[model samples]
Target: MNFLVYAGVKLFTLLLLMLAGGLFLKALDRLIFPEVDFAHELREDNEAVAKVVAAAILAWAIALALVLG
Candidate 1:
């Protein structure tokens, strides 16, 4: 039960971090490349951004599991 609680908390935290990171990256891209079309880039290839967010969440989950376990 304690492990479960810790995992849940860590998962939630990781998700929030992923979301914030995604938004921040998007904003940064827009600010850096105002002339470039972000929406088109995202539509053309979402895998890049998805991979980043997924990796962050996965890393956090693994770290939390190792520390909590």
Candidate 2:
């Protein structure tokens, strides 16, 4: 039960981090490339960004599991 709770917490944290990171990246893109039409770029490249964010979250989750399990 404790391990389950720990895993759940880690998963939740990982998701939040991924979401925040994705938003931050989008904001940075807007700031750096104000004329680039990020919404259109996002529509085209969302999958790539999602994959990168997922990879990052997964890495963090795995590390947390190893350390806390």
Candidate 3:
């Protein structure tokens, strides 16, 4: 039905937006911390890096929710 098609497209768009948001976060991290390796830090049990990433993700989710609404 047309509703099913619309729902599928909306879901696909949401998935793409989530992927883009993650890439944006990664790019922002690299831009802000050119020398620091967040992946390595996270592997080394760096709480600070985890917290920062979590905060960024939360912020991104909030922004997405607002936009979607």
Q: Identify the leading candidate in terms of lDDT.
A: 3
Return the TM-score for each candidate structure.
0.58, 0.55, 0.81
Using TM-score as the measure, the top candidate is 3
Q: What pairs collide in candidate 3?
A: none
3-65: candidate 2 lDDT, tens digit per residue: 999879888886786687668767876897788664575578777756755675587668656
**Superposed Cα RMSD, model 3:** 1.5
Q: Sort by lDDT, best first.
A: 3, 1, 2
Question: Between 1 and 3, whose lDDT is larger?
Answer: 3
Candidate 2 lDDT score relative to the true structure: 0.71
Tens-digit per-residue lDDT, 1-69, candidate 1: 999998799788767866776687679768977886656755778777567556766876686567555
After TM-score superposition, the amount by which residue 40's alpha carbon in candidate 1 deviates from its true location, in angstroms, is 0.8
Among all windows of 10 consecutive residues in model 2, the one with the lowest summed lDDT is 60-69
The global C-alpha lDDT for each of the candidates, from Candidate 1 onward, is 0.71, 0.71, 0.87
After superposing candidate 1, which stretches have Cα over 4 Å from the reference? 42-69
For residue 4, what is the lDDT in candidate 2?
Answer: 100
